[model samples]
Target chain A: MKIAIIQFGGSNCDMDVLHIFKDILNVNAELVWYKNKDLSGYDGVVLPGGFSYGDYLRSGAIASRTPIMDSVKKIANEGKPVLGICNGFQILTEASLLDGALMTNSYPKFICDWTYLKVENNNTIFTSRFNEGEVIKIPVAHKEGNYYNTPERLNELNNNHQVAFRYVNQKGHLTNESNPNGSVENIAGITNSKGNVLGLMPHPERAAESILGSKDGLKLFLSMVDYFSNE
Target chain B: MEYYAEVTVQLKDGMLDPEGSTIKRALEHLGYSPKDVKSAKKFIITIESESIDKAKDTVDEMCRRLIANPVIHDYSIIMREA
Candidate 1:
């Protein structure tokens, strides 16, 4: 399937994701810049993490208003899969494609480490390869990764099972120390109402290889391939 | 006429303001007791308009569209002759 790796002005992880898709996964992916609006040719889209626009104004505020974002929304409306990682997740929320806002970390510090994430739902194409309640290790690096929303909305999202991942300990327990950025209810990832749009705070692309200390992320990419391969 | 608009954007109440909390902690460590602290952004923009009424409207739109996100932020604007 053709996937578009969207790149913004200050996006540094664009090439990293491109390498994962092109070299590691051997999938057909292209880097589409923020200004390019035509996205009808691509089957899916990936918004990788980075400090876009130097994290100006807000984490993803400026980038969400870019020209290509309208196209990203268009494809998402067409039921195409869209994966957003870290700052990409911020952009998705800022664009109102997803719910909640990623606020500054509770400690107000930039944290970078491998975090354990429990697969909260395996029903979606993004997490179907993994078993329900499975735990995977992925790296997260950001200061504004703390997720926040109204209590009513958070309850609604949880009731709908839209929460895709949650921070947990190595033993798969939700402990206070396991939550690195103090995200609400230990939420690490979520999907939109349609389940075609996913926004995750961790960098799965950074952990897709064994040499990088984990291959857990490979299943996620493979799941994407498996999804369209069936179609 | 030229008007300068000053906009203050702040996180809404009941939202966790981590940056503000950190600052509050530092102040407490310095022996100052503060009930709480809230951080905000002040944006000053100069608008070219025919009247003060029009300048206020322009700055208000700018805050709504760009400077402030209605989801988590509330902003107020002040205008004066440049």
Candidate 2:
């Protein structure tokens, strides 16, 4: 399947995402500049991580208003799969593609390290490869990764099974210590109401290759491939 | 005539307050009572308009579209004729 990795100004992980799609998954992928409006040819879109707009006026605040985001919204509305990683997740929140806002970490520090993520809902196209409650290791790096949603909205997300991942301890138990940013309910990733769009504060592209220390993140990409291939 | 509009945006209750908590800690260290203190942001805009209604409309639009994220932040706009 052809995947489009969106490249916005200051997007640092676009190349890494592209390489994972091309070199690892052997899928047809291309980098789509943020100014491009046409996304008709691509089956899926990936918003990779980085300090978009240098994180000047809040993380992802300025990048969310880029011209290409209109097309991104259109594609997402069409039920095509879309994944936002790290700063891309922040942009998705800023763009209202997903619910809730990512705020400063409760600890007030930028955290960067491999974090254990529990797969909360594996039925979605993004996490179908993993079983529910299974823990996966991925790297998270962000200062504003704490997810904040109203109690009513959080309840709705829980009822709809929209929560995708939760930080977990090494023993596979969910704990506060596992939460890198003190996100609500230890949430690390979530999906839109339609379940077609997902946003996670982890750097899956950074761990797609075993040579990079681990290949656990490859399953996420492979799961997306399986999703489109089955359609 | 010149009019001033005050817009205050605050996070909804029950939402985590990392920034506010940080300030509270700093204030506590300074030997001040910072308990139950919540932080908010405000924007004061001065505009030249013919009528108060026109100024209110303009500032309301700004608050709705730019100053606040309706999903998380609630804002109040107050106008004062200058």
TM-score, chain B, each candidate: 0.97, 0.81
Top model number, TM-score: 1
How much is A204 displaced in model 1, in angstroms? 0.6
The sequence of per-residue lDDT tens digits that candidate 2 reaches over residues A79-118 is 9999999999999999999999898898989988999988
Error of 2 at A113 (Å): 1.3
Least accurate stretch of 10 residues (summed lDDT) in model 1 chain A? A217-226
Winner by DockQ? 1
